[model samples]
Target chain A: MRTILILKRLITVFYYLIFIGLIAQLFRIINQIITGKIHDLKPKIFGEQLDYGTMSLFEIGLSGVVPVVLFYCFFQSLIYLKRSLKDLESGNYFSALVITNFKKIGILFLVCSLGEVIGKLLFFIVFKSKFHFELDSSVVLFFIMGLFFMFLSEVFQKARRLQQENELTI
Target chain B: MLAKREMKSKELAEIIGITTANLSILKSGKAKAVRFSTLEAICKALDCQPSDILEYKED
Candidate 1:
């Protein structure tokens, strides 16, 4: 219980830090764009940096959108994580809300990671570019973590059913 | 069973040392299981056997 409290505090700190860092980075990029020094920035999408000069406006917009979407997914997962941790601290392991949140977190992770892969595939197909199948370790980790959360939600669901049955047995 | 035994649900619930809500749950067939002690209490209060109250049906 003490450990969970400590962990929750740590997560809260990290959550704020990440949020601030992302926002700061966004402002810095905007500042640079306004200053007309965009060439100095090497922005990456799905871990690969693209040549902005050669790419069309649509491609640049798509690249920019993907990172923002991924960040949103990450933030959402963190929010759910914080909520689940709070529930755990309150000894609410089998709550429906926590279970649903876990499921949502898993889905968000899976969709974000898998969507990156699918987006890469589609980009390569549309552009008739050389298909280089490079699997980032982080993406694989996200996928596995997503599956684990999904499994956790299922286990919680079963435990909740047993608890209800036990409670009603009287 | 309470109707046949001329006992109110509240009266039976008090006699069994359980809440009326639980009694309602049992009456409404919403309870997942019944304990032996609870079954014994219900049978003793209603003056009936377990078999009289419990019935199996094919779903």
Candidate 2:
């Protein structure tokens, strides 16, 4: 019980940090453009720079709309996570529920992740970046993985709902 | 896999200010989402815990 509580707190911290970090990455890129420096400023993971191709249609689509959509998705996921954890702590896991919207988001992520892999391979072939592009397929993959995690949580939520309904009818 | 359960899906709906269809959706687990306040009203009308309306399985 104590361990779960600690873990929940840790999860909250991770959520906050990742959100802030993503925002900071965007900020740095915007700032660099304002100052007119050619130095790369895109976010990095595991010491390797990622490529975000300017000519990639996938990236162009993601730029104006994908960021907002991804952020909305992540926010909705966090809400569900918050509810599930609360239910768990209350020993109400049997009553918790997950909506179908979450599942759709999960599948969306899965598709996007695959798309990103294709994007990465294509970019490499085209020599889109000498160092790395502004948008990395890796981050897109991470977003998709996050959706996968949410999908799993939704499964648990459905299980809980089923349990609660059974108890009522019997 | 076992016997199906019954829900006052309509009676509860009328009291809770939801349409019969919405209540049915929730009762049938076809609902995309549920409001907390609606859940609370359903619990009250049905005179049961939320668990009474939801169940768990091991698979």
Candidate 3:
């Protein structure tokens, strides 16, 4: 239960980071567009950017889709975990939601990580063809964080098994 | 000869990985079976042998 709460809180932070990262970029754009010279504020795709800033349809479309899928999968995992914890605390062990949704979350995280990697590679290809943007280390860093969660899920599963065995003996 | 080593199940359980409730079940022999790992952990925690645990009844 405590572990679930920790995970739940972390998910909130995770989503917040995602929102902040994306919105910061948009705000930068907003600041540029608002400056007195709107004519000089033509949409520009810098070669050094790793984003959906100013790009052709196919590239931007792929970038746009990844974040949507990542968010969808992440929120779905969070909701499942929340419901699972609520059910358990209300004394519904038979319907332990975490155990049920654990595997699905693992799968989604894997997919999300893959999407991130692919998006990074795509950005590297498209943008570097114009100008050089240093690859962001934060991408791999977050993916490592995802792996840490995956490892934790395994530990939770083991702990659950031990708990169940103890209960059965009683 | 049962040289007794006295300890409450709860006390033993706190020291061990298993719960007091589980220890109670084991002590009463109501437990269906004990896994070797759990058994080892219990024995180690209690500082005793299986013979210290299992009672002998001569029929």
Candidate 4:
């Protein structure tokens, strides 16, 4: 019980941190765009700095939109996970809401991972840059953890059914 | 019947291998259905006929 409380508190803290970090990143990106710092940052393409002015409006729009969408999805997934943990802490492990949230988190993680890969590919093509792709461990971990929670939700569903049967047995 | 037979609910529950809560569920008529095995156990513990303890009424 104490461990659960501590974990809940820790997750809450992490949730706040992630929220703040996302906001900070958003501000930073906005500042960069407004101040024309993005153009000066020297984003490399084919071993040379690509001038942002040369990029089309569509490419720039996509670059900005993709990061924001990825962050939103990742943050929302964490929010769902935190809520599920809160349900568990309250001894509502077998709740349908928890299961739904878990499934949502799983799907969001999968989407984030796939979106990251596709977004990078699009960026590479648009910039005519060195094609760089690497399997990110954190994204993989999140995806696996999401799947595990989804599996746990199913187990909880079965356990809840058995509990009901036991209650009705006599 | 239990009152007339001077039997305690606790003792009956112990003999029938069920909890007092389950016994209460039965007494309250909240149970959806009763299994034959449980009905048999209850009948044996109470020393009564199934008919003596059960009745049907139209909803």
Candidate 5:
């Protein structure tokens, strides 16, 4: 229990850090757009520097959609994670709601990771750029962590059923 | 009946092989269900018939 409490606190701190990081990213993107930096598509692509430019407005718009969707999914997973941690802190370890939230977080992480891969493929096709495709370690880690949480959710569901049975047993 | 039989709750619980807390649950009518084995143990410990102790009431 003490370990869970400490872990919950650590997760809370990490959540705040991620939230701040996301805000900084948003601000940086806004600054870049305001300074016309977005017009030059020479930015980093899949962790590799690409010198491609001369993209159509529609292509740029489509490229922007991927990152936005990725961020939305990531943030949503974080929300579910926070809720699950809160439920744990409240001593509702076997709660069905917590299990549902864990499953949601897991699915969202999977969506984000898959979305990144698909987005990279779409970017390569639409932009007609010679980009090296390398799998991101962080995205892979997220995918594995998502699977772990999904497994944990199943374990919790079983434990919840046992708890209910114990409570009802005379 | 325990007072008439000179048996404490602890004694009854010990005879029935259950904790006092669980016996209290049965006594308080908070138990969801009781097994026949446990019911028989309780009846044997108290020296009573099932009809003497068990009563059904609708929720």
Candidate 6:
């Protein structure tokens, strides 16, 4: 329980960090745009080499949609993780909330991680390059972690059923 | 057995050191399983054999 509390605090800090990082990134892009230094912005701002001077605001905005969706999925997963940790700290081992949160976290992890692959595929398709599906180690790790959490949700479901049976037995 | 012994469900629960809710569960056949100690206590309190109160049915 104490470890869970510590982890909860850590996740809370990480959550804030991710939020701040996104804000900083947004501010940096806006600052660069305002200063007419759009060329100085990161090359892969939208998972591609965006030609700022040649592209309209709407085109740039459209490019941001994928990143926004990935960020949302990651953020929602973190929220569910925090909730699951809170439930565990409260001694809700096999509760429905924990199970659902774990499942949601798993799904979000998969979805957000898959965004990278989709971005790579778009790069290949747009450039008419060779089809090289190179899997990054971190992406594979996240994918496995997602699957593990999904397995954990099923385990908890079974445990909850057993707990109910035990409780009903006199 | 409770009626023959002129005892209420609440009285039986109290005598057997269990909650009335649990006693109600036992009576309604909603309980998954009964402990031997609880069954023995019930039988002793009602002055009856386990066979007198327990029935087996195929599901």
Could you report the DockQ of all the candidates, in the order they appear? 0.67, 0.04, 0.19, 0.48, 0.52, 0.80
TM-score for chain B of each model, two decimals: 0.90, 0.71, 0.68, 0.88, 0.88, 0.93
* Ten-residue stretch with the least lDDT total in model 5 chain B: B26-35
lDDT digits (tens) for residues A1-170 of candidate 4: 88888888998999999888878867976898899776554444323455667667576665567667887898898888788887789887778888788778878887887887777777676666567675678767866876786787687789878777776867
Models ranked on TM-score: 6, 1, 5, 4, 3, 2
Candidate 5 Cα deviation (angstroms), residue B52: 7.5
Which pairs of residues clash in candidate 3, taking residues 3 or more apart in a chain or in different chains?
A47-A131
Off by over 4 Å in 2: A38-80, A94-105, A128-162, B1-59
| Candidate 3 accuracy as TM-score | 0.45
Model 4, position A170: C-alpha lDDT score: 79
- Evaluated at residue B52, the lDDT of candidate 3 is 70
Error of model 5, residue B57, in angstroms: 14
lDDT of 2: 0.59
TM values, all candidates: 0.78, 0.44, 0.45, 0.70, 0.71, 0.84
Report lDDT per candidate: 0.85, 0.59, 0.61, 0.78, 0.82, 0.83
Q: What's the residue-level lDDT of A104 in candidate 4?
A: 84
Q: Per-residue lDDT for A29-103 in model 2, tens only?
A: 678768864244343322435444332545533433534454565566565565566666777654424344345
True contacts kept of each: 0.74, 0.00, 0.32, 0.53, 0.68, 0.84
Runs in model 3 deviating more than 4 A are A1-60, A87-96, A127-137, B1-31, B34-59
In candidate 4, how many Å is residue B50 off? 5.2
The number of clashing residue pairs in model 1 is 0
lDDT of 2 by residue, B1-59 (tens): 11132545565668888787766676677655566788788777767788877775564
Which candidate number maximizes DockQ? 6
- Chain B alone, candidate 6, TM-score of 0.93
